[model samples]
Target: ILEEHAFVDELAEREIPVVPASRIDGRTLHSFAGYRFSVFPRRGGRAPELGDSATLEWIGRFIGRIHAVGALTPFQHRPALNPQTFGRDPFDYLRNHGFLPPELAATWASVVEQALEGVARCYERAGELPLLRLHGDCHGGNVLWTPDGPHFVDFDDSRMGPAVQDLWMLLSGERQEMVGQMADVLAGYEDFCDFHPRQLYLVEALRTLRLIHYSAWLAMRWDDPAFPAAFPWFNTQRYWQDRILELREQVALMDEPPLWPV
Candidate 1:
């Protein structure tokens, strides 16, 4: 939580549109009863409409602004979003715990291995990336659109990673549709920070990693009462089957040429 506060403070210093932790008697975090609490004022705004071209472009501009600041420095303690952390470590945990259904374990393992190989290929193509501090989980839900513009919330997932870590989640729909969306986003994004076309290679690769990481997260949290109640489908045969299917699709998608902005 302290790391989140520091990163948000950094963005706030640059005048980025973001929600910052409110100071309580000059202390950003207050410790009480063996727990830490942060005070953030309730700000009003609705979830963004990604389908709207104007909104997409507008949101893209602010993301670009955030990246411009993000590129200026590195996080002191946050982990980098990478295959090892997002892919290998999580998979190891799930496998050791026997999270997969016995009958489908081999099938899921095979698909995950293939997906990781594809992720590797994509990374190789991307080469060495220009890593920077990132919003880490910059999906539309985190972006609240007000009359002035969008204000990003939830720095808890913030980490050091490529700029595309923030940009890719904004894209949606079929391949052709995503291409058009990328054009709209980059139109505004390029206004602030320079973007590398090669980073496109990580688009599907990163999505695959998120999939693996999400399943692991769900399994890891299963001991918590909320997880079982909320994600009842998890650990079921149908869930594993669906995940296997998704990874199969991701393997194919990662092989396709990246959606480079025109």
Candidate 2:
């Protein structure tokens, strides 16, 4: 709630075309609505459209500015429950839950372990760089558009986490050579927070772990009639369950399991 308000104030203060300000209503849960609900600018406009140089450039600039604000602000809205802190990393979430199929368990486990290792190494690397607050969740759904260009919304998940957490979702998708695109996005974000390789891996693992937790929750709540079926978890795709788990394996295989390492 505070993050949303801060975003509204920050964007408006910067003259960015963000959604209108929202005010808390009398109802519980602090319900509020914005004066400007989006039409989503263009029907199929999304990061995947970054294939176009112009679109990619626009995305780059917008993200750059957004990240700049993150550096300027110290306050952040924290989540009620953080999976990275509580849940067994992304791979474990899939394994313990019924999210993954038995056949792919080993492969998924291997991959995610590797990614986790990479995440740790990334933290080590980031030790040399400065840290700051970030969007926490920078994805297509939170980013809407207007006549001017792309506008970000939904700052509920805002936090003082790795900037890569923001970059991962913005750059994670079926787009070709997404890693390259991710690198490009990092370059753009660097104009603000100063990207480090470790921060990149940390954010990737955090984002992937976030998804794993989200998927499990979605699977549990999917049966509710009011719940929409469009969520990735609702679709029962193996990759959704295995994606982060596979990455973690790469992290695990890199070094012997560290029982107690700084």
Candidate 1 segments exceeding 4 Å error? none
- Candidate 1 differs from the real structure by a C-alpha RMSD in angstroms, to one decimal, of 1.5
TM-score of each prediction: 0.96, 0.62
lDDT string for model 2 (146-246, tens) is 45577766565666655556666655444345656765665555564455555443544454466456655565676676666465445455554556455
The digit string of per-residue lDDT tens for model 1 on 3-92 reads 778878888898888989999898899989998888898988998989888888998898898888887878888788899999999889
Q: Which candidate should be chosen as best, given lDDT against the real structure?
A: 1
Worst 10 residues of 1 by lDDT: 253-262
Worst 10 residues of 2 by lDDT: 253-262
Model 2 stretches with alpha carbons more than 4 Å out: 24-48, 80-83, 86-118, 172-193, 203-207, 219-224, 228-262
Error of 2 at 133 (Å): 3.3
User: What TM-score should be assigned to candidate 2?
Assistant: 0.62
